[model samples]
Target: MNDDEKTRDYNKAVAAFAKRYLPYKQPLLKTIENFSPELADVVIRHGLYEIWEEMTPLLSYRDKEIATLAALITDNTVMKEITAHTENCLIQGMSKKEVLEILTVLTLYIGVPKIINVMDAVKQAFENYDQHIKNKG
Candidate 1:
């Protein structure tokens, strides 16, 4: 494909992927698009569509969400992302018990403080998800 065609195809794929996976309808990408289209392009095209969707053969969406949640918990620096992935986990059919168990077990490896931080974020994420469903209804 020509460069223009490749770019168009990539943008289309990113849009499709982001529509499905992005949190809060992707306000993050939308906000950045105005001032930083390139960064937004990278986030959607490479980060979400390429890295995430292209891994479906090896990892299911639920597995990816679980892994992402675990990493976010360990990092404990981006509460918003942690919460977003927490909601994504639930949306992917991960039960509250399963999520809690995962976090609880992580306390063994990643320590209590980081796990505690994510625990709070998880709870809030659940609450927010519930509210979102209600509002949508």
Candidate 2:
């Protein structure tokens, strides 16, 4: 495809993926809309569609989710973002026990202090998952 065609395809795929996977909250979307159109475009087009889509083939969704969780735990990332990703991990087929184990292992590498917040996030995710299951049933 030509450059224009490729860009169009990427845009479409990105929008669809964001709607499904990385949907921004309305306030966040509005902020992006006003201040950083290019960043918003890259997140949708490149981060979700291009990067994540390309990586999905190489790693199982669960595996990628676990890896992402591990990295975020180690790096002491934004708690809310980490919690959201943990929820995504569960939604993508990771078990709560599995997530806990991954976080436990991360403690060895990143130290215990860094893992405290991750543990709390994982606990919240598990509670939410359980609530979701109960609601479904």
Winning candidate number (TM-score): 1
Candidate 1, residues 23-122, lDDT tens digits: the string is 4656666676777878876776667767876656599888988999899888889998898888888878888889899988998999998887777788
Cα lDDT of model 2 by residue, 48-96, tens digit: 6666776567876667777877777778977776876787787787777
* Cα misplacement distance, residue 11 of candidate 2 (Å): 5.3
Candidate 1: residue 133 Cα off by (Å): 2.7
Give the TM-score (vs. native) of candidate 1: 0.83
TM-score of each: 0.83, 0.76
Candidate No. with top lDDT: 1
Clashing pairs in 1: none
Q: Assess each prediction's global lDDT (C-alpha) against the native.
A: 0.78, 0.69
